[model samples]
Target: MIPEPDPALARSLADDLAAAGYTGARLRALWGVAADEAIGRGRALPARREAAATDSAVAILARLFFLGSPVRESEASAALTNVTIDGAERLGLVRMSSGSVTPSVMIRPQAYVDEHGAGEWWIASDIDESVRPGPLPEDHVLGVGGASLTLAGLQLPTSAARVLDLGSGCGIQSLRARRDSPDVTATDISEAALRFTRLNAQLNAVDGIRTLRGSLFDPVQGEVFDRIVSNPPFVITPRGADVPAYEYRDGGLTGDALVCHIVMGAGVHLVPGGIAQLLGNWEYVDGEDGLHRVRDWIAASPVPLDAWVIERDRMDPIAYAELWIRDGGTVPGTDEFETMLAAWLDDFEARGVREVGFGYILLRRRTEGSPALLRFERVEGAIGPNAALGMHLAESLRAHDRQARLSDAELAEAVLLVAGDVTEARHYLPGAEDPSVIELRQGGGFGRTLAVDPALAALVGASDGDLPVGRLIAAIAELLEVDPDALLSDLLPRVRGLLDDGFLTFAGGEASPSA
Candidate 1:
């Protein structure tokens, strides 16, 4: 009988690997020798008997190495399995139902940290050569990738007793949360992903990262979280098809279905006053507003929430369709590639999707009667500290709420002073002198320049929070010698826009949205 492998033996191998300069390519070479030895003898190799052998093997593979390469798998089976194929099967070293040993079944490695090193080692899926490969292994660990780190850093810093990392692929976000929060629960649809998360947590020296296997929100029923973070599969897939094996990229939904569903359901899972922050994409319909769609979803929600939605970037349908197709490794000239691309465009067009917009969404639960703030604005770049633009928005929301209870005269008395650091400028025509243009420019914080009509400019100048807006407009009309009706008609919209953009603020209580 083959001896059971010792976990310590794996650690020794990893140490030797570090000493031997075992880059990924060199590790594969060593793995081939090991596999050849086992296959040539046609028998199951005994479990590692000596620390030296394990060390020697690991010294050649290194901690940064991933052992799932096909060449390495072949080598591992040949070196580690018994010469007698049947003996290998009896030991659970290889599945014997198939006449020949399959690398997937026969070549399994026990990942471990190098004895002298600090980071953890993990086993991952062997790169698949198949067209439509099976889902990732139940314990399939992953290499560090950009998106994983992005989500980790983007999470809001809050100490919560309980936190949830939904769609926790490779467990990177979960690990970060566990480091910051007292308790963390991670969930994913793939069993392999869950297993990988567990292994990764252990590797990273993080304990208490609970792993659950289920779709988003399904695994955490009846549980409320102080903070919930997700980097879910937001890519809208074609209809009637299972997405590729990369669970990290595919949400298994068609045309913004996943985003809408998640946003609509998130409120139910959050504790009163809890925050839900997520990265998502929405399809922009030709006639319907994208912001309005998200607003409608939140409005239909059974729970009350204050929401902030920012559209960071948008791509035309054709460009969006082709981007994901290429990401899936579809070659443009191939027939299969053409079919997939065509399908994506057809579906998008059928749904009236003209553009795909990506953004960050933040929602907070509020008390009854709190007005929900739904904002849709175009941002210049990626979401990060550079996008710290949202910080002022929180203050703005509070100000608006305070402004709501004031009387019309009190509102009129509210003087609109430009924020500190804002400068007012007047631009004159080159030759013909009509009314000079009045512009307000701000150097920072939601940078914008607005062209103020002469009447509105005079009213804004006169506003000292003493008179109501209606009387102020009337006074400004009298002073400017213009028709009050025409001035009000032209200036009302401009004033509202300025308020919305944070250029102007009411003097007294906070400013609320106009009905």
Candidate 2:
């Protein structure tokens, strides 16, 4: 059930929370450090044990919401002076029965920092397995989780008149989107989810997020948004009696078809030059690559788009099945767990599935271009600091647009600056005077490291915004005794790659999208 929302009471609750200094940092300090870390691993006992020691307002709220501990009515009311015990019950946040206050849902204090600033939100949603007993309900609404944070971090910090948050569970993405876009449209199939979204918006005291109830793009058909973001329910689940389809993860379609539909619909919903970002899972079956299948899905879009999909990791059928089954609250070493595992295995076997690929998908509608970009690859290493990734992505999109218009000769005439966070490392044999390996490592962006031939390394070394790339190439060639034309031919394309990947940015040249 969606929490009953009283905007007036929610505002008071927010005030009370702020006055109590309730935040991710304060909560961690109130409880022991180990207990804080245990919360992420779904082991709430440590936190519960520590929380039991204090009846302070913050501790009480943490125990009630974060640790799922029942609270005494009078104490809870005293802590939340504005919301009060009766008001909390009126807002459907807690149940008052037998003189104790039991939380009907969890309201976590989420801390985040962005280009705008640092802030916190009181995010409310149905409790998960970590805090709840028994199996999760089918229509369970999820609170702040890893996937939500991933999609939240992936949102480009670019300005837009309108933004759309597809499948906005608990409205986390919507809150994040409203950071850049003045107006945001949050959509979902579940009415309860929409209610939670509304309640969350109210709790945050953030305006301009209008919630709509419908599946996919059905709620706002024919409307165009400057940006669309989704952390859709893309989990591939078996369609069987024994298996339970948790609405928070599974999209209730065969395989990754729901993901396919979401990808295909991006073109229809976004305006020209608009962008869509999503996190999804794709299946690899019948000897086909999952990434290529995603490419095909983009190619089949009614509207042309420049696609960049990164496969973070892949899991074989058995491992994937076990992971999801365990996530569904079915512990292993039990008959029910084995039966559910069999159902998943049988489903995969019937479909010829071999593995599942999970990752982020980025699509941008082509403004007008003879050469629309399509980049698909696996990022094997950890992505750089996530908080700054939005700004990084915004710069990347701008760089792509600017560079796409420049030819090889034009690119050579532009001055570039090596990114500040970049460094060069050389490896050599102990007895050798010369280095055998040279790598250009970026400490930011995707945290990529590239092996560079001596000539390319020299070019990067001399790129200090003092001379045009062509002039630098000419000087390096003269010093190294290589032909200038030949050197330019060799390194200009590599320079372009560096520019696109953010190892280098234009110094005196126009590279910013606004420019």
The number of the candidate with the highest lDDT is 2
lDDT of 1 by residue, 8-116 (tens): 3333333333445444444435445564355233322221121114445342122112322122344334333323334433422234333334333212232222112
Instruction: Give the poorly placed runs of model 2, Cα more than 4 Å off.
Output: 384-387, 509-515
- Candidate 2 per-residue lDDT over residues 68-99, each given as its tens digit: 88998877887889888888888888898888
Residue-pair clashes per candidate: 38, 0
Most TM-score-accurate candidate: 2
Give per-model TM-scores.
0.59, 0.97
How much is the lDDT of residue 335 in candidate 2? 88
Candidate 1, residue 421: lDDT = 46
> Mind sharing the TM-score for model 1?
0.59
Residue-pair clashes, model 2:
0
